[model samples]
Target: MERSVIHNLIAALPVAVVAVDHEARVSAANVAASALLGENLTDRPFVTVLRHPVVVQAVDAVLDPAHVSLPVPDPTLAAVGSGGYRNRVIISARGRDIPAEVTVSALPDRIGALVVIEDSSGIEEAEQQRRDFVANVSHELRTPLTAMIGFIETLRGPARDDAAARDRFLSIMETEAARMNRLVMDLLSLSRVESEERRRPAEAVDLTMIIGAVVATLTPHAEAHNVNISLIGAENEALVTGDPDQLTQVFHNLVENAVKYGGSGGEVRLELSRIRHEPALRGPAIAVAVIDRGEGIDEMHLPRLTERFYRVDNHRSRQQGGTGLGLAIVKHIIGRHRGRLRIESVKGQGSRFTVILPAKRDRR
Candidate 1:
């Protein structure tokens, strides 16, 4: 094959590819390889371009048939540090270390060898997120499970003959179990919302109706705390393209949070308005603000409010039956609708959580 044809073939591949000559010099490199190892890789010694010791060793072994059987570094151990026979290696490129899976194959007829590098940064990040998610879920579940087990043991033994103690322990166990259930439910909801975040909902939804339903649903709970929940603005139907159920969930979570955290005997207001432009939305949008009159969130905690299981007041949140995933769920739901969630708070005053959704343009 013509050299240009060969180079074009290599360039077409998604992974980085480089060919090394018998003298250990890079004879050919695809665009991806150049981009990965830096430009001007052609004719450079393979060792100089791939500085990782393990990667260099793997390439050298592939080039030299005699050392083909030489054991390569263990990939698991190689991942921990530089250099190894491992399939995964970290290569320094443009002052940044990139995680990549390396594959070395010897060419036919004692020719040079080919090295393919597949970037694995995204994979590693996703794996890390999975690990963290599992750990968080385990910790959340364990707390309640441990409490329930202890109560069970007490009920079965020490509190068997004590009706008052048994009753109290059972009540506590029930509460713990309920908490576990809520956490599981919230986790499921979060998973579903995240899975659908990239797909915009096409259904036309009325923000007014969604907010109204949410207020009606949470009114009793708000009344119990002497916190009045009121819906203001947008007398007409404020329509937006979204999923009604998810929109309902979005407002429910926000309004419920407002009522729960808003100070006792205070008012929680849900305000809606049509706007021509919102910086976050970048177009005409409908903005819904769930404002509360309770002790406001500190500025420091505002940025992390939408993070999963992040709580400003853990004890109070647990006491109030908060799953700690409410805002996280709301955030995801809003994102699915191509909307933005903005949090503004001031100490000792109140907080406002706003949702800005793009307005459906008139097709006329």
Candidate 2:
């Protein structure tokens, strides 16, 4: 392949590639580099454009020839840092605020420097998410487990001789056991939604039917909370093509949350409608909106509401028996359906969660 062809191939490989001259001016860039670092980097210095503190340090280290060795925190990003002629640095980029894995290599016979950038934001974010998940899961599980253990110990050691004491301990144990069961179920549901999201499942499901079923299931919970949960515009069927089980879970999560977290005795409404214009989709879309008359979400926290294990109020969420995975599961399910999830909230009024899915294609 010619030089342009080679550059094009590398650029097309999803790795951001930039070559800098001895004077630190951009010698060449691949398509990925231009797209990631911006389209205007042909004659600019790589450092001046990227401006990541970590990258600057790595490039300086590679060109110095005096620094014998330097460290790159991540082993995957260590390839460039280990070599004297080249050093790899993990840096956060401006505008996008994305962390990139970059490798800087000096050309043979001191020609110039080769810089390769890879956006590691997804991988790094996933790792951090895993750590947070483990910590959250551990803490969640420990609460009920500790309570059950203490109750059991009291019943077995002293309360064993007293019927009244034994009865009280058993009652407490039941509640703790129930709490544990709820946590495990939510965790399993979250895992199932995430695992199945990567592969698209084609099954024709009626939106009205799914909404009705979810409402029926949550009726008792709604009644207990003195709240009304009902499906609106259910007279006509709205069809959506996706996994029924996952979609049902999405509906259940949203409705159940309305009862649990929405304001006391407020109305929880579910509506199914169609949108002719949605920028995220190519054509007409099917939209499902769940409106709640509860204490709404803060505008600032709206963007991060879908993050796993994220809570608006940790103490209140735990007290209300929430696992904090409901919204995250809703997000993954919508993603599996190739849809968009939008949350609109007002501090004192309420919240409306909208899920927009592609309309089923017709065949003659």
Candidate 3:
């Protein structure tokens, strides 16, 4: 077939495609293929562009019927049809080894082979993340369950005759049980937030009131930790399009976190204000900042603070009854409101978590 005809044919494809002529040289390549494989793909040696042995053999078989490795029928080829040979191979593209599924098919009359490459990077990454999430949940649940089981066996055996030991064991068991319960609850909340993340909240909720209520609710906990939780700039009503319950949860998590981890400075403050033109929110907005005067977080940890189940200090988080999903849930809630969360911190200057929400909902 003519190189121009081959070019026109494969150019219509949305995926990456490279065509090799009877001489085993690249005859044509689509835009997508050039972008994936790199520049100047046309007329380059196919082996130089993609040096994988399996891919070279597949092209060889398609180009020359008498080649040792002729096409063999694969049950998996039911999707691609009997005319095509498919293989998953890693191809070096722009200095990076990229995972891809390449399908090689012979052109009519032994003209050449048409190779289609499908990038599988995204699919593989998502699968890995799913596996990690399952493993993390299993570990979180197993730790407390195992502790509680050991404690139960002890109380039923040697500790049965000792009242003091029984009381202590029971208390420890209670704490472990609560930990398990909190993990389950946080998982449920995370799931719920993710589910509703695309749905914009329509209710005009009072942000000022919500912050006040959260401050009131966590004041006792703050006092117990020798921390003072205060709400500032809440004298006037601040309304935004959001779910009241979710907003309440967002502030509750932030305030509780400030008290638990940043309470060393003895002061956690919530600062609320109105922004006339917030760049991120695209208009006038309301920003509620949860600030802590305690020892600040490292700059490195700020970027990943909203990642699910990620904690700066695992031991400290567990001891403080943190499930590590609090910030994740807060992020989703703010997203559903078409807002953004900003984290600012220095090694010793404390941290500021600012939640910015657009004052008006987009009706367009």
Candidate 4:
């Protein structure tokens, strides 16, 4: 191919590519390569442009006269021959170290070598998340598992002859087991929600009805704790496209949380309205706010409320049987519905959790 054509093809590649001559001087560098390694790489030694010792050594091996005389390996292959050639390295870019997969291939006609750099940032992030998730899950499960095992041993030995002690230990054991069960269920639910987040729900749902049902279902629990649950605003039907089951879970979790934590304030309100020109929603939307009158959350904790296993008061959260995945699940469900979830709270005053869904366009 013509030199210009080759350069154009290299420029179009998503990964960074740089071509070097027999002396390891850069002959052509694509746009990605320039952005990563800095511009003005033409005629610059590969060692200076790449900086990484492993990459420079690979380039040297590819340009070696002994290998150049032999038939050049296929350029289509991802990496050069596997003679302990380092194919991965960290490079500094835009003031940050970026992990990249470097592949060196011998150029046809034995002119030089081609260096391909593939950014591995996404892969690294995913791997880190997997590790963190496993660690968090293990820690969460271990606490309850330890308690259950201790109680079992007591019931088998020390508490065996004491009926009252055995009963109490059994009750404690049951609660611990239930907590573990809830945690596993929440984890599974979160996994499912994340997997389906990219697919928009096609079914039309009534926002008002879902809210009313959630309120009615939780009213008794609220009453038991002296909290009055009420649905206010938007008496008319508010329609939107979403998954009804998931929406129900979203409202249920929010209201349950309010009753659990805000019941001391004596009132939990569900407000609905239709609004246009909201900045976050960016269009017409049906807004549902789950407002509580209890002691509100701190400003610092608000941002991380949707994070998995995050809690403001860990002891209180555990006592309340919270899995710490409620808000995370709600956040994902709203996102899947092409909506937004916003939290506004004033310490010692109250907090409001709002869900905004795009309003269904009128077909008539």
Model 1 steric clash pairs: 54-83, 54-84, 72-85, 73-85, 75-86, 263-294
| TM-score for candidate 4, residues paired by index | 0.90
Between candidates 3 and 4, the lDDT winner: 3
How does model 3 score by TM-score?
0.90
TM-score of 2: 0.79
Candidate 3 residue runs with Cα over 4 Å from true position: 1-13, 68-79, 108-110, 361-364
lDDT of 2 at 196: 79
Candidate 4 per-residue lDDT over residues 30-108, each given as its tens digit: 9888888898988888888878765776677777845632223523223436431337668877678998888888777
Off by over 4 Å in 4: 65-86, 278-282
lDDT of all predictions, in order shown? 0.83, 0.77, 0.87, 0.86
Per-residue lDDT of candidate 2, residues 138-206 (tens digit): 988898888888888887787789998888878877877777788888788878877878898788888
Candidate 1 TM-score over all chains jointly: 0.86
**C-alpha RMSD (angstroms) for model 4:** 3.8
User: How well is each residue in 209-253 modelled by candidate 1, as lDDT tens digits?
Assistant: 888888888999888888888889958988899999999888888
Off by over 4 Å in 2: 1-13, 20-26, 31-113
**Any idea what lDDT model 4 has?**
0.86
Task: Write candidate 3's Cα lDDT for 133-227 as tens digits.
Answer: 89889989898889889988998898889999999988988998898899899899999989999998888898988898898888988899899
Position 201, candidate 3: lDDT: 88
Better of 1 and 2 by lDDT: 1
